[model samples]
Target: MPREITVALVQMAPELANPEANLRKMGDFVEKICTEQRTDLIVFPELSYTGTELGLKATDLAERVPGHATNYLAKRANEFNSYVVFGLVIKEKVESILYNGVVCLGPEGDVVTDYRKV
Candidate 1:
C-alpha cells in the first residue's frame, strides 16, 4: 500500500511590534511540525507573517512580492522538505505601500505559487 501523507495545521499567536520575533515564532512552529513523528503537508495561518496587518488606505503594510517574507518562508520549507502555506506583507518598489500576500512552498524548497490579497 502507498504511504499516506500526514498534514499538520499549526495555530498560534505571535508577539506584537516585532517582525523578527514573529518570523522566528512562525519558523519555529514550522520546525516543530516537521519534526513530529509524521507529517507531509504543513499549512499555516492566512496572515501568518505580519499578523496579516493590512492598511486601510495604503498597502505599505504588505511586503514586496517575492520579498523577504517569502524568502524566509522558502528557507524554512527547504529545511524540512515539506510543503507550507503562510501569509505575509508584500511590498512593491513601484509603490511605497505594502499589501497582504500569501505563498505556497513545495517539498523541493521552491515556491510553487504566490498571491497578493487586496
Candidate 2:
C-alpha cells in the first residue's frame, strides 16, 4: 500500500521587513493547523520572512542557516510532531553573500536540508 502524506500549504502575506511578526503569524498558522488535523508536512510561500519587494534591504535581513528563523520553525515542528518548510534569506560566512533559500525542518525539530533558488 502507498503511504499517505498530509501536507498543508500556507498562503499568507509576510510583514515587510518585520521577521518577528512574520514568525509569530507563521506560528499561529501552525498551531491552528495542527489543532485541526494531523499534518505530515507544512509549507509556506517563498520569501515568507521578509516579503518580496525588499530589494537591497534583503541583505540586512539575511541570516545564516540554523539561525533564528529556522530555530523558531523547528520548535513548532517539534511541538506538533510534523515537518515544516519555509523560505528565508540566507547568509553565508561572508556577510555580503546571500541566497534565496528554503529550509526544511524535520519532525525532530532539526534542520533536514536547505535549497537555494537559482
Give the least accurate 10-residue stretch of model 2, judged by summed lDDT. 47-56
lDDT scores of the candidates, listed in order: 0.72, 0.94
* Number of backbone-clashing residue pairs for each candidate, in the order shown: 13, 0
lDDT for residue 115 in candidate 1, whole number 0-100: 80
State the displacement of the C-alpha of residue 87, model 1, in Å, after optimal TM-score superposition.
0.5
Candidate with top lDDT is 2
Cα RMSD to native, each candidate?
2.8, 0.7
Q: What clash pairs does model 2 have?
A: none
Q: Which stretches of candidate 1 lie over 4 Å from their true place?
A: 1-3, 53-61, 96-98
lDDT per residue, candidate 1, 62-106, as tens digits? 666566766787788888888888877666776765556678887
Q: Model 2 RMSD to the real structure?
A: 0.7
Query: Mind giving the per-residue lDDT tens digits that candidate 2 earns over 1-118?
Result: 9999999999999989999999999989999999999999999999898788889999999999999999999999999999999998999999998899999999999999999877
Q: What C-alpha root-mean-square deviation, in Å, does candidate 1 show against the real structure?
A: 2.8
